[model samples]
Each structure stands twice: as C-alpha cells, then as structure tokens.
Target: MTGPTTIGAAPYDALLLFSFGGPDEHDDVMPFLRNVTAGKGIPDSRLAQVAEHYEHVGGRSPINGQNLALMAALRAELSRRGVELPIIWGNRNWAPYTRDALIELRDRGATRVLALVTSAYSSYSGCRQYREDLALTAGSLEEELGHDLGLRFDKVRSYFNHPGFVAGNTDAVVEAYEQLRARGADLANAPLVFVTHSIPDTMEDASGAARPSYRTQHLDIAAVVAEQAGQRLGVDLTWSLAFCSRSGPPSQPWLEPDVNDGLRELAAGGTTAVVLAPIGFVSDHMEVVYDLDTEAMETARELGLTAVRAGTVGTRPVFVEGLIDLVLERAAVERGESPARAVVGRLGPVADACLPGCCRQRAGVDSGVPALCGQD
Candidate 1:
C-alpha cells in the first residue's frame, strides 16, 4: 500500500458519479443509441429497430433516473457519515458530460477528484472507457479553461465481492422467494437461473488482469445467494447462467444459453418453477426491464412455467455502504494500509485502474480513453 499524501486534501474535492446515460425523451433516443454503438458499423436502421424496445417503455429508460436517485442517496449517505465529499452526476452519452463535469469540478475548486462509475466488471465499456473519458475531458479542460488544471483522479475497484453487495443481492432473491410463496407458488424445487447482459465471448475471455471470469464471477455470487436462500427456506435450488439483451450480429457470438432457451430447457426437463437472479447487473436497466421482464416472462408463460424475476441491488442501503467500502478499501491500499475487510480471493492485479493489456479497444475505433495514464 502507498502512503497517504501529506498535502492536505482539498476541502471542495468532488466525487464524480459517472454512468452510461440513457435517452430521457423520444427524440433523444436515436442519438443516444448512436453514441452507445459508435464504431460498431451498426446502421441507423438497425438502431431504429432496436429503438422500438425503448419505445415500448415510453421511449425513456429507467437508467438515467435510477442513476440520479443513486447519486442522491450516495450524497446523503456520505453527508450523514461526515465524509464531506461533493458529488456531481455525469453521463457518457447524455446530459452532464464528462467534460462539463470536469469544468464544474474545476469551477468549484476541486483539484483532486474521485470517480465512481456504475459498472462493476472488467471490460472496455465497464472499466477503460471511463478512464478514457476522464483523460479526454481533462485534456479538453486544459484547453478550454486556459490553464493547466492538474486533476488527480482515482476510481473504486469492482465490488462484486463486497459483503454489502452480496448481502443486498441475496436479500433480493430471498424476498422474491417470499413473494412466490405468498402467491401460492411452490419453490421447493425451483430452478435458480442467474442472468446477465451477454457480451461477446471473446471480450469476456479477455477481461481482467488474468483471463477474465465475468461469467464465473456472476455465477459465484448466484451460488452464494442460492445456498443461503435454500438453507433458510429449505428448498432445493439449482443455479445456472443465462444471457440476455444480446444485440450484435448473429455472426458475432455472445454469451449463451439465452434466457429464453434456458427457460425452454427447464420447462422441458420437468422444472416446475424458476427464480431469475440478475447477478450480472447493479441496477434494473432496460436489459432487466424489457429483456427479462417482458421477453423472458412472455417466454416462460408460453412454456407454462412459473417464473419470478428478482430485482437488482440498486441504491439499497447496503449497496451504498458497499460502494463506500470499496472506495475506502482502495484508498487504504493506496495509502499503504491493509484493508480492514477481507475481499474474496480471485486472480487479478490489485489496482483501481485497469491494466494496460486489459480490455483492448477495437481497431479503427478510438477507445476514447487511453489504456493507462502514463503508458499512452
């Protein structure tokens, strides 16, 4: 662990809340879609077709508002704890951009800033893009502000193993179990299916310091939750991973067995009921709402299998505390102090920033962020 800086930390320091922004209105949908799919060669027609998914939900994604609510909750939590960090929200493809937030932090005399991105896994979009955003935004600030504003930025590490995260997700699954019981549903032999957004298999295979275990990580969380739920409720629960919200071309292989296919199999195999725990995501984004709630639910109904979807661990008090713990844990390491809490032992380097070889950006498309601060 590195020692804490002797220089007094700034009083007006900011904690930038970064997220993958969503379209709030109908008209913003196409443009927001473009930003998200930049460099993918996805034509507007394809995006327009996909826009129908958003249109189904009134052309507004719950992500932006959910992120705002999380930010507010985090601010309140920090304030109550007397942490005194000013938090500002920014989106990658919507209002309150990285450059704008950097200027705001600068205007508020925040020389040192901490960034907390909504993503919790290793990948280009999840980890590297935010750093790229910061670098680009900071460089732009140097030109716009007419001064070299040296900004020191640090981010929190993935919190998949945090106790609060585990506890919150476990509680969500347990609550869903209770709800099923209330509705006269038998969960004694329920199939526990854990779902996550399906990224390209190549991407998943290449993530992290070692080989990425994106699929395995989610499964690990699901196993813990399933064990606890089964132990408490005295039920036999078998868990498996399913992919959802896959939009790339058919040739570009993504993670599988698709949720719908999984449901079909479970139903054919004499599985009476299923409880889907979204361990791969942090919030109830469009993927969770439309993909799981709408599409998966319809499929399960058609198959005559009772399906119950668990909610995400979004802005739960324990989840917020988990975020705080992640930050403090990283800060402790940076300050050369041993973390008070024990993290799950996994194969990976111990740095908040992604490694140079981690999450290689696609060719012909600027990653919009450099791999590391000093490397590029």
Candidate 2:
C-alpha cells in the first residue's frame, strides 16, 4: 500500500476509487447479478439470462480488474504530481465493497476523502446512483459501528467533457477508422456510430436540470470526439448516437434505436462499414465487451457491413493525467484557490458541485438525503 503524501491542499487526505464491481468467476455470476439487480424485482429467469452475458466473458466482468489497475495508476500519477495521498478502492457491488473500503479509510485516520467514480455522466445510474451508494454506505457504517467515524467523502466533478477524456476517445476513433480502412472499408462511405447505455426515457428526461443531463452529456461527448477525429482523418465525418444494453420489462420503454438496429438501418442505407465509438462509457466493461463487441458485431456481420469498435479512456495516459488534474482542481477549490477549471467540450464548464435536484432520481425515490459531495 502506497502511503499518503501532501495532496491535502483542501484538508482531504485520502482518495477513493469507486466503481461498479463484477463477478470474477462462473460460480460468482448469479450472485453478482443478484447483487446488481437487487431491489429491482427482476426475476430469477431474467437474472439467469443476464448471467449468460457474464458467462460469455468467462463468467466474470473485467471492470473490477480495470478498477484495480486504475487505482494503481492514479496512485502513481498522484505521487508523480507531488500530491502524496493514500488512494483506496471500493465498489457498489462484489468484494471490497464501499463500506469495507470506508472502514479501511477510517482505520487509516482519513477524515476527508475525495471520490472518483468510474462513471463520467450525469444520470441516475451513472452519477446519482454512485452518490446514493456513498451515502447509504456511510449511513450504514455509522449505524453499525455506532460512531461518526469523522468521515467526509466528496466526489470529483464529472469529466465527460474533460480534454483528456475527449482526446482519448478521439484517438481511439481515429485508430478504429484506420483499422476499418485496412480491412477494405471505404472511409468515404463509413458512418460513425456513437453508442451508449440506454436509460429509461423518464430517467433521461430527469437527469441534471441545471446542467447537461445524461443523454445530452453523451451526445456532447460524441460530437466532440467525432469532430476532433474527423479533423485528424482530414474528412467531414457523418455520425449518429445509438443506445445499447437495454434491460426492462417488455412494456417499459428505454432509449432507442438500439445499436444493432442502427447497424441494420445503416446497411439498408447502403453504408458499407461503420466505426463504433463508445464515448458514453469511461472504460471497457461488460456492456462494451458483450453488447458492442459480441452482440452488435454479430449484427453487423449478419447485415454484411464491416464494423470496428473504438476503445474507451481506460488508463490512457492523458486520461490518467486528467484525473490527477481534477483532484488537484478540487483540492484548490477546497483551499479557496482559484484554479482554471478544465473542460474540453462546448457545453461546459459544468459545476464542480451539483445543484439541488441536479441529476435527480426518477419519481418515488428519496432526493432529500444529503449528498456527500457535489450537490449544492
């Protein structure tokens, strides 16, 4: 375990790498799915179906390992930046859960900690749910331990439009296009498809009120990457946003058109190939691996169109450096220092803290619980 350094410009002494956890083996798949879909009333049959997706990838999701790698990377980056802080990790699901991590932080004498959630958008599932996890875990800890623990957790600002994130996606898109061209794809006819996880329409409608919401965030990032990648390829590229990994009751509506459907439509429109850029996600999780790489790729094959999937900002050098920048920026703000806020897209600068009702949960959920960070 790397020891803490002088990263406490804001009185914060620790960093938490919070993420959505995944199962590590076939035997753990059902239990992992149950953990994920808990309180959703999803049927066992449905969970079994979902388990197949994890099973397809060896009954495990790569996100936990990725988070571990990211934790190490951020530690190294923070150390290199001279902000000596102990960084720990916790997940919303699976082992090393948020409560456990908080216990470790509490034992380490960390009173104030900055959290870096894996998701970078403002939506119920992406942003708000993470806040909920932190709050719930903290409440549980206090209740179970019968002590305040003096823990204060503040989340970093959303980085959907950060230059490092945008640059990484742009580079990945350019690389995907290059690979497609090498595979006899005619760049002139290949349309860019930007894909993201589809939330319910109501959830999308209610995402950040004072700032760009979830759907809008994804769209903005897509536009930025598409424009920059187009400039790199020296061509005016046409692009559209598509949704994937939709799960709900048959009657309930989610975002559309699905990626497979988009591919089919592109094929019908006489498009020979498409470059898929999943700018909506920060890393390659099960959604990207199975939904895009396996399912959508299969659809493209059936439609006789060549498809190439771009990478996410998974430990990219620029992205890692950007995380450090964000941490320092928050610390500066905490210390009453004026730091130039960093943003790469046009819809920003988003607030380092969220306003009340920003990214509100869908109706029927409690919104009054004090968010540990980023809500004014």
lDDT of 2 by residue, 1-376 (tens): 3555574545778889888888888888898889989989998998988888876788789998888888888888877766688888888988888888999999999998988889888787877778878888899889998989799878889888888888888989999999987998778789999999998987887785567768788888788888888898888789999999898886888989999999999999999889988888888999999999999999999998888999988999989998888888898888888899888766876676666676766644556765667654
The C-alpha local distance difference test score for the whole of candidate 1 amounts to 0.76
| lDDT for each residue of candidate 1 in 265-371, tens digit (9 for 90 to 100) | 99999987888888878899888989998999999899998888998899999999778666556656656767666455353333565545656544224444544
CA shift of 289, model 1, Å: 0.8
Model 2, residue pairs in steric clash? 5-84, 5-85, 6-84, 354-374
Q: Give the poorly placed runs of model 2, Cα more than 4 Å off.
A: 1-9, 363-370
Relative to the true structure, candidate 1 reaches a TM of: 0.90
Clashing pairs in 1: 1-336, 2-335, 2-336, 132-369
TM-score of each: 0.90, 0.96
Q: Rate the local accuracy (lDDT) of all candidates.
A: 0.76, 0.85
Candidate 1 displacement at residue 135 in angstroms: 1.9
- The candidate maximizing lDDT is 2
